[model samples]
Target: MKLSSADIARYVASDISDGSYVNLGIGMPMLVSDYIPEEREFILHTENGMLGMGPAAAEGEEDWDIVNAGKQAVSILQGGSYFHHADSFAMIRGGHIDISILGAYEVAANGDIANWLIPGPRPPAVGGAMDLVAGAKQVWVMLSSHVSKNGEPKVVESCALPLTGVGCVNRIYSDLAIIDITADGPLVTAMMEGLKREDLQAKTGAILNFVPKCEILKSFKNEA
Candidate 1:
């Protein structure tokens, strides 16, 4: 299946359990909140010191003080609260967060992550990603199937960039497929509609083992 970045985000949101204490990383990770069911209770924690975060606000409702790891203006749900940055990290480092969804540049077969920095000149800053990767109970990665604009594979034998966390990722939700890192290898748990296992393998750099289909649960319905 040809899935877009938004499809990856929706996939991540669908897996998040109700009442999960989640921390979203920068970039595409921020979009997961948009797909969450409003009636379900989930508390979003920002590493910069806010909790109970609502989705991105409407045009006139943004509060500068309430933002996420991306520093974009956000809103607070009814039971939302704020705290100090140190306390926020404390929660993360203490493993209080149930899941942390992050964007990645590359992920290895062993679940090693390399998302914090680009490999060339003018590299982006490595924010709280390192801590989140190491601390969260489960690390969910949202990214594309390939690396570089040239369509190099992002799922690789080993990451070329500086590492974010070794064996830190639990599940990967990508544009083309959903992968779970197991002792055997990177298992293709699910693929987008119409995409074949061979087609996905051609695009991926890592050795992929296609697990037989089971009763897979639908996570999100396309609204648009």
Candidate 2:
């Protein structure tokens, strides 16, 4: 079976190094906060002007004034602080972020990402994606689906939508596999248990190179 969102989040959280200043994009990327290792320390950054954010607020304990960029209620760690929006972006653009885990609509094998704008007429909200990709020390993508709802591959040879950042992605954690964007190309470092290489390739739009030892992913829970 393919990994669920929680499983993927756990994998991503475990891969995060200790003492890193990280940013979590909205949507599935937000789920990562619930799974970060208890022993590890991470200072979560929110684009809406929050630093050192904690997990989601419990039921009826939410303070609407304190929310993430996605407007979801969240708790602030002991030393967490709120600042001006400009200062929050300054932290991103000034290269202070260690990693930014973002959700992607499409990720090219070359590491280009397109998540902000589709082909629709709705006004686009690029948000902080461009800044995060350009300024973060590493950019990791979280893909909730290997393919779109319409059955199109989300990992493609090239993105069809407008580029978010050119050759900026460093890694990808998907429901099916963990891929690294290397100089050679997108390398499959791990795959879901019981999934065949051919099966994964069929769901992807790009040619994939596998590492010598591709590990199998198992279901995981939030230990926090």
Candidate 3:
């Protein structure tokens, strides 16, 4: 079975190094805050002008003024503070963030990402992704599925949608696997349980290489 969105978020959270400054993009990327290990301390940043961001607030405990870039009510850590939008973008553009976790519509094997727009009725919105991709030391994408709803692969030889940032993504955390974008191409570092290397390759558009000891990803729901 494929991993759930929450499972993927937990796995992504587990992979983040301790003491890193991380910026979580809106949507599924925001869920990662809920699964970070208690022992690890991360400085979460929001483009809408908040730092030391915490997880989603409990129902009825929300502080309307405290929200993430997604505009969802969120909790703020003890040392958290707010600033102007200019200062937030300044922090982002200054390369203070270590990793940026973003959601995407398609990611190319070469590390290009296209997430802001799809070929539909909605107006295109780039948001802060362009700045994050250019500023963050590393960019990791979070996707709910490896394939589009019509069975088209999201990981491909090249992104079909308009590019957000070229050759910017460093890794991809999808429901099916964790892939690193390398000069050689997309490399599989971990895969969902019940899938084989060949099975993954069949669903991917670009060629996939795997490490000798690719780890099998399991649900973290049962972990202590």
Kindly list the per-residue Cα lDDT of model 1 for residues 35-103, writing each as its tens digit.
786666779998888888877767887878777777788888788888998899899999999999988
Candidate 3's displacement at residue 196, Å, is 1.4
Steric collisions counted per model: 2, 0, 0
Score each candidate by Cα lDDT. 0.82, 0.91, 0.91
**Which stretch of 10 consecutive residues in model 3 shows the poorest summed lDDT?**
116-125
- lDDT of model 3 at residue 149? 94
TM match of model 3 to true structure: 0.94
Residue-by-residue lDDT tens digits, candidate 3, 65-155: 9998889899889888899989998888898889999998899999999987777888777789899998899999998999999999999
lDDT of 2 by residue, 120-224 (tens): 888888888899999898999999888999999999999999999999999999999999999988899999989999999999999999999899998764344
Question: Model 2 reaches what TM-score against the true structure?
Answer: 0.94
Task: List runs of model 1 lying over 4 Å from the truth.
Answer: 145-147, 214-224
RMSD of 2: 1.9
Model 3 CA deviation exceeding 4 Å by range: 221-224
Task: Candidate 3: give the clashing pairs.
Answer: none
